[model samples]
Target: MSSIIPGTQNALTAWQPFNGARLSVTSKTSGVSSSLPNSLQVQIPKVVSGPIGFENTGYWGIKVQSGWTYQGSFYAKSTSFSESVVVSLKSTRGTVFASKAVMGISTSWTKFTFEFQPSASADTDENVFNVAVDGKAAAGQTIFFSMFSLFPPTFRGRENGMRIDLAEALAATQPSIWRFGISVATRWKWNETIGRLEDRPGRPNTDGLGLLEYLNWVEDLGAEPILGVWDGISTANYSDLSTWTVVPEADLQPYVDDVLNELEFIVGDAKTTEGGKLRASLGRTEPYALKYIEIGNEDQFQPESYAAYRWNAFVTAIGAKYPDFEFIATTLPSTALTPAYQRIDFHMYNSPSWFTANAFMFDDYPRNGTKWFIGEYAVTSTNDTNTLGDIPSGRLPYPTLQGSAAEAAFMTGMERNSDVVFASAYAPSFQHIRNYQWTPDIMTYDASRVVKSTSYYVQQLFSTNRGTHVLDTTPVSSNDTAPLFWVASYNNETDVVFLKVSNTGSQDLVANIFLGFTATDFATATAISTPALSPISGLFNVSNTLEEPELIIPVATSFALPFSDRFNYTFPATSVTVIALQSTTALEV
Candidate 1:
């Protein structure tokens, strides 16, 4: 929680005037620079009934917890006499949760910092980070403020770290990898997001999601990092973001050099490499366990420049140095090169029906070749019925039973082809309920509460129960899969058999699974199904929203794996289920 002030085009539009305080934005000097030019200027009115200043309802709300220290700092300059200023965290109704006062602030430009510990937590997130002054004492005076920030206790107590509650929720998922920056708007600017927060030019200290912080995040989650580097190409006619700028081949070396420097900082020896030394100076003596460096994101939009040399230029340059790092290409690898690519990343965002119908899409691929990573996949539409085939209509707002079930079926297909499909992740993982452009995100949150979607539970069930090898079954196959799809896997490490099933149609199916290997003593079944909480029609299409986050959550019960080779399970009309049974022996593949 760095500065409550948002960098919205570096404007003062985020502040709300309070108690007759006239507020205006200015392009000023001293504490300001050209990068972030606009600063908040407050003009105090004549003596009034209460204090006069500005308030920021951060990201729609500010969450305050009891006995938690809120650290804040800001720069200010006064046109006339030195005046006292009051900074506080409180509800909009004027109930102060925490308060601090700076006595007789200097008239010349100076920095002020404060630490506030609230005795009581706020009832709701309808609060504000506020600043004010005595209207009577500072009557008719003008003041300028810049570079403001406030933060609660950080995740893992890392200075300027991630939000704790969000981090904890992600940890529970047992994530295997975290994709850092995938789009052009958020191209991984390695140079701008590292070292001391203060030294990072243009960005405020609250801008702490730097490269180091990202690596620390990967470390904390016990996951590998997929670093996405910019390859000088933007989405066609996307926006005014770049005027569709594509860096010339002559100028591509600097970008290639930037990628090498980034890798050096991450995995190079602290004593031998310049980038590594810089990292060591920042107190990261040990190298981060990073290996995958993805070149660009979906660069195929402009195939001419990308395939011609852009991809190979980076691959050739970096591969010569760090040959061990596996490269994942967002675009199709050049066929001319030997061993086309180590891994390829592909994305898909379509309808739920499309996902279920195409569940076996990967099964047709040749088994022995370049591995694949489905970096992004999601069910975004009601159907492909829109007038424009591209503009999907009646999109899902949250993960519905039908959508999640469809995703599960697709997962089962991937698990069946696990050797070729190395990994897959849902696209647009998180969203804030207050404002969002994308729908059906895996996790949704607000200022204070987090809501896991039905899709989230599906992901957790599969990820937590992923086994060592796909197990072979006997008798009737579970792949009568138009309505029901399944895949059985054996975890050699734990001696457990994980059977995942997904029923995607209106009618339920009774699966009688007969394994060649003997079953273990007991078993448990976990499922995300149509909600029984209330009688809602069209159960399959039912979804979970912020108002009812737990409406369609996974339910678990003590079930049993048959003493012999067969155990029966009745798959619900629209649901995804996982059964884990202890098994000492597995059938041969």
Candidate 2:
């Protein structure tokens, strides 16, 4: 049983990004230092002396902050083959962060990457970057390098908000039913040289994240694992994408059966040589959960074949055995809704401009018949450094904040229509520190540490505080001129009412909130705010380097508490505020 405290106004305050932080890029060599070829690229000084190495002596680095896998890639080619090359990340204090050695082949360009988890003793910190070619280089053989990256392995409770306690709390609230998921064609990369860390063959991939890794990641995020099946043919290059479907069902069966069998073991029917299961049940100590199976990722390119080759087979075999779970297809026959499938899926990266022009884009789609999920999305202007591409509009004055606000607004829409928009998440949630393709992401990490963007805080605000009841907010005319103003209240079972007020205009406005409630046990109020008109510039290239990140955070302040039903509040122009009201109805008095 829950009820909202009607019309309550609490004087709000402010909160900012971490104040003492800064991020800067400094060159270690005595020679010239320049910017790299791409937008996110930063240049390191060319070292050409004693050891004849291309080692990153002084640059940013990150740690394997909890996870079993790390992934990153960079291109390097030399005039001579057979030169010794080691791509590594080390701490300023000389501790080895993480590294992968690449054996120089021919004069042709080669991309080297490593996937690893922290050693038992590994600890995370800032100042991490790509450490490349740590040995002697041939006198006349120069090497070029770009697109260096790293992805740590997934572990239980390691995701941003999927802590065990948090998951349990969500379950306790029981707002929605749990669903299992998986991917078929998406994120199912093959570890061709699956044996060694360095020797494993690598290339551009269609799979967003490896299939096993994606399931593990989703489970860690507290979402039921929805497996996406692939046409599974291991490749040393993206050019050799699997043709199991393009050819014939006879050709696809062997690959399909093998993967399905392997998956069974990962999901608990089969056992691992490591002697332990992959995941635990909800709150289990082991921390992996799998409940859904998806046929393929974005199979629209080969819909007919995909349906016959993978989807049909999946429905026949796995579906027969696990009829209880839901099946999600990327697209239906023609209509927006279909009862044949449990849910419909869409992938959106149509530039931030697309969202700005059509914020209610999803509303145009019919929801009376089926459920939908924006499986993968991002507001990035560019995709993987491709410039001839669509440049997204809605660019923020600040690059760091641009993607954040847009994403939050988009998410609010999803939440408002959860009946149809079942799930929404940003695609390519990560980027290799220096190998970024997109303009902005929620969180970024190198081999050493993680950094939060303006978007991260926004997501944290809504996610950390789940609202149980939605209040009815109505608009009214005011004599006092100000920017657009709107306020809504949410009452969580936690005995707190969260009042969120937004002033999108340039003029400051005085706001008065009137509270009507059943009880009166008043408590303190707090706020998280983002102020407008900062003296700092909002350029996309602007970063709070190790020397100065304060350019990004919100400032914090407090106000005296009042146990009054009617109160006055000031709305700062172009700011976001979260005001919590004390519960007057749940008092002992």
| Candidate 2 lDDT for residue 562 | 62
Candidate 2 local lDDT, residue 226: 51
Give the TM-scores of the predictions, in the order they appear. 0.91, 0.56
Candidate 1 has which clashing residue pairs, if any?
3-149
Off by over 4 Å in 1: 1-10, 32-38, 46-49, 79-81, 107-109, 186-188, 198-208, 236-243, 333-339, 386-393, 474-480, 532-534, 584-589
Q: How accurate locally, in lDDT, is each candidate?
A: 0.77, 0.45
**Candidate 2 residue runs with Cα over 4 Å from true position:** 1-223, 231-250, 270-287, 300-310, 332-339, 350-369, 382-399, 446-449, 475-492, 501-533, 537-548, 554-574, 586-589
Lowest lDDT 10-residue stretch of candidate 2: 10-19
What tens digits encode model 2's per-residue C-alpha lDDT throughout 1-589? 0011111121000100111111122222111112222111122234333332333322233443434455566555544435655555555454665566667545544666556554434453543443443223443344444334444442353422232332342333222223323323233334331222223222233222333444454443455555555553221222334543354776777756655554544544324422124222222234235555556666665566655555666666666655665677765544322235667677666443354334445545675667777776665552333311333443322224444444444555565456677766555444445556554555554444345555445555555555555454433312132233333345546656665544434345677667655324343332223335455422332333323434455444445446466566775544445566657554321
Looking at candidate 1, what is the lDDT of residue 226? 90
